[model samples]
Target chain A: MNTTLTERILGGDVRSAGRLMRWVDDDLPEARHELAALYPHTGRAYLVGVTGNPGSGKSTLVNALVAHLRASGKTVGVVAVDPTSPFSGGAILGDRVRMQQHSLDRGVFIRSVATRGNLGGISRSTPAMVQVLDAMGFDVVIIETVGVGQDEVDIVRLADTNIVVTVPGLGDDVQAEKAGLMEIADIFVINKSDQTGADRLLRELRTMLHLRPRDAATEWTPPVLKTIAVRDEGIDTLLTNIEAHTSWLSAHGARHQRDRTRAQQFVRLIVTEALSHRLNHALASSDWQSTLDALLARTQNPHDAADALLNAILEPR
Target chain B: MSQEPKPRTYRVLIGKPGLDGHDRGAKVIARALRDAGFEVIYSGLHQTPEMLVRIALQEDVDCIGLSILSGAHNTLMPEIVRLLEAEGAGDIFVFGGGIIPENDIGPLKEAGVRAIFTPGTPTTEVIEYLREACANRYQ
Candidate 1:
């Protein structure tokens, strides 16, 4: 795709938007250039990450949330990360089967990504992809992780407001609480609230929240909103809670703090890229296979070997 | 232990486009392709069509597959083909699979999408198709 098409995508061209994401996914050489061109327009969108365990009804919740945002005339972009099979590296039919209902809405764009051992249970390139959406002027970007527990928690690091979802029938909410998902959530959604045991789960969640230690200095308490998302019941309340959290973050300057955290992540990406570049250029010239063999054989520590590689990068031929 | 020789590497790029964040099939297909001895570069979910085409050009892959369960395939797939023309990836074979309606399959293929693998497509079909398509494309 040319710069014109990339620009057209930022100008709200649907076709261009689709193409831009592909470039990022494929890690095309043009990925950086295309994203950089669109970077100036980003930082305007509100990024929200919705995550929870599988069967927590997060997709339905997200659907309701998208409808809420679109009704308010916001352009919404959704990134759903599906779990990859351990052996096949292929996606299971989860998110794709979940939200094919909104195919006609022009304001909503949903892209499903497969997570193939992206260590940390999140897509390694997710943050950059979010920046692409933000840059494209999506008023709201909701990133939904593959609701597979802790691995899905990486959404919190990439999102501005991470919403942790839970449901009634899933045993104890404490498992979620103990996982510290409760700690990262700006808004906790109890979906499928119309179910019989909904109230019990809510009570358990509240009880855990009570017992959990708070960040002594901060007065902001994350709200727990119950919803029957499929019916769209209480979604407005969830939206209201989200708005409240966003307003609170802005008012308390916590949004900036989150931005600084995101900035560090970008820094980490750059450092990783530079290190890889240096290493591959230098060590790739060495017997990379033998070197790896030596390391695996416990003859050399990775750090020392890395130092040796870095030295090679600096050393003249 | 007698190690099996690595199969001849065939690289494919699979992408999801435009606001459809459902990627289960894409991941599965990518993984299956990898295990079948093809080197795969997967763009983690939610890429646009323009992004996919550009990546196909850059990675110099043998094939490009897309999973679009969002039903925007009509609007998005054509755009991918158009961009592929610009990037000179017109020769790169493109295929898609997902919640595609049976009727839309005809149009998708007419737009030059080589194949449309819907839900329930056996992974073996994909591996076999790629082996054939890549051989022919290269030849």
Candidate 2:
């Protein structure tokens, strides 16, 4: 009567899933094995990425979105990412404060992760955690990244629907021309739209979208919507637009393409990590130390030393 | 490939349970724990025992640190431990802080709370106790 953790997760065990998520964050080998077994059950849940600047109400907006989704009878999971301290390596994950209303709901699972040292808006183990949630049969998995402005486009590669949230007074319209967040957004949200500059921001966004070069007849135009997330205003419209994007993705065969890309990226990252681990192990050996000594003595040049090291590790002994 | 596995980064939930609206003490402790390299999930103010236990279970944290100042620690602290035990998560360590009377500490600990730090206790003491306590529990 021994049931595996993977089996328990598939049987709707929240405790098991929560433990696996912790294992994933700790980089435990058992977690990898369980994830390999659980991979086949994934891809059934829709992944939504929500990213915005600090103080932009991303968590509030996510709370509203989750409430709306629950009203429609869908199970939800959230992976909220917060930044770890570069000096102390600790993090205060306070996103759950905004999301306390859903804490008692069995159908909702929320997990917080620290970025550790990852440069992207997400943690290194985010995709794996998403897989755990997906396998656990959540209808929708929402990823709320650490507050990011521009140049954090990694969410585009993982999420089926990438939503870039901006507020009215952040000068986002001009910053959008800088080319990172603007290009990665599948949809744009102007939260806190009751503020003074809401209309100006909206007009600037529309003009920018209009000026962009695209095949308007066939391409999917990213819609710019407005919302006051604290009052839960416009969340229903936002959810409808998200669903519209989901359907458009399936109808245009983009979902399959995205799935393939995600798979390829995941496999490549695994290989890279394994190779990096092996290289670090090799570099700690006496032979590599001798090489380092020779390089310090200037008898072996830097390029030659690197070549020898790579050859020693990559070649089958 | 026989290297030792990395230590688990113990996560602690700093919850302000019951009707206590003043959370400055909780926030200070949360920041101190973060500086000591423990991931701290702050539940903000006005949380019930049900909500705190639910968050602790979902986060899979190693410890629950309840901060209360409204003199309801006797009722609220034990209720959290009971709810956590009911959910089969009794192994998760529970601790408390804030204005608890010296008389109530023994009963709270008897009810499965491992430790309690009263007001004016140094933040480093809490961090050190957690490190030792959690290491023993997990090992």
Candidate 3:
């Protein structure tokens, strides 16, 4: 059954793809069977991350970029991740509202994901979701994230090219120089460029780049581009730079390096989750409950209890 | 009922179809559903029945709410349910809202619309209905 569904998804059945993604979001045990089937067919699509602070026009920019990509005959998949409501665990993925122009396009597929209380705003399922789109034959996959604190940096792990968007007159220049945003930005976009402080924001971004140290051997000159995404201005230039960056990745073999780093992080993430799950299972025993009681009673030190738990877990059962 | 409750992430797609451009109601319902703990995707104005169904399939929404005010509910609303059935997605719950007349409600429900929300219905009603309708869907 899973293989048939996987085949259908690979054959461009959007329904099958959607069902699989829902399974992933719900963390169903059966999702792994289909994901394993889809794994080998992934890795062909270009992954781009669009991130910026709230109200920075990331959605509009991504919508324009999707239009541009479609005009050039590319099939695009978009994952717009929004913060989850802590109370209800629900999310209003308004990014899909901004990009609704492409909603009916057969060549485009857009999925909105909730952060689901995941720290850093980007969901842990995003990379796997992108792989699903890639396996489904999207030429490009764009992950647009709510760029709250740490989100801009977290997206770097998933994207082949990361574009950090900001608006003018928002005091974003000082915010950009705060280290995290400036470091992960492969392309800096001053969206709403027709606004008052466009030029100043552009200059500030340039100055920050100049002040930052670079590796002379493989220095990527991250271009600062301006765009009024509502009017579709500067979209062509943005696409051109994206193409150049992809080409640069291939030319310098940095794509492989990036993939290797992504693989390492992926493995580490899975290992950490697995270890936590196993530890929790081990700690559920009556012996561990006694240990906890001892710690609470101040009969055993925390370090000694921790060593005992580790020894218990490591011992052959 | 005494067991611990698992986290719920029910996805609902709210669509506005046909030429009637009033999306305020749709947006309001979408937000309400979001606040009620359902992931809501609002398909903006002027979506076709085909487009709505496609969005539902691609989005894997558990339910679809179509809002139309062009008095085309007789034609458009049933067409969405038909498409869902034809696409082997009949299990996907279909509902409607708009300036739908009282006379048309029975036919819409017969055509597989589980419920309809007219202009003055409270948002909580829809949320409450969906919670029960979609509860038993998952094993």
Best by lDDT: 2
Q: In model 1, what is the error at residue A76, expressed in angstroms? A: 0.4
Show model 2 residue runs off by greater than 4 Å: A315-317, B1-7
**Which stretches of model 3 miss by more than 4 angstroms?**
A1-3, A149-151, A282-285, A311-317, B1-8
Q: Give Cα distance to truth, residue A103, candidate 3, Å.
A: 2.3
Expressed as tens digits, the lDDT of each residue in B1-139 for candidate 1 is: 0121112345577777877888778888876886775556566566767656654543446678888888799988878887777765587778888889999989888998899888888999988988898777645
Q: Please compute DockQ, using alpha carbons, for every candidate against the native two-chain complex.
A: 0.11, 0.73, 0.57
Q: Report the lDDT tens digits of candidate 1 across residue range A1-317.
A: 35575677767665456555656655556667777787777788898998887888877888878888888999888887766566755443245335544545667677666565675545766777778778777899999887776645567667888888888777676577667687778888888888888888877777877787777457578778889888899999888888988988898898988888887887787678666777777666656677789999999889988777777776654
Interface RMSD, candidate 1? 9.4
State residue B131's C-alpha deviation in candidate 3, in Å.
Answer: 1.2
Better of 1 and 2 by lDDT: 2
Cα RMSDs of all predictions?
8.3, 2.4, 3.1
Location of the lowest summed lDDT over 10 successive residues in candidate 3 chain B: B1-10
- When only the first chain is scored, the TM-scores of the models are 0.87, 0.95, 0.94
TM-score value, chain A, candidate 3: 0.94
Ranking by DockQ: 2, 3, 1
lDDT of 3 by residue, A1-317 (tens): 45587999999998889888887777777778888999899889999999887888999999999999999999999999998888878887767778877867989999888899887658877777888999999999999987684435778888899998888877766666774788888899989999998998898899889888988568788999999999999999999999999999998999998888877877787677666766887889999999889989999899999888777776665
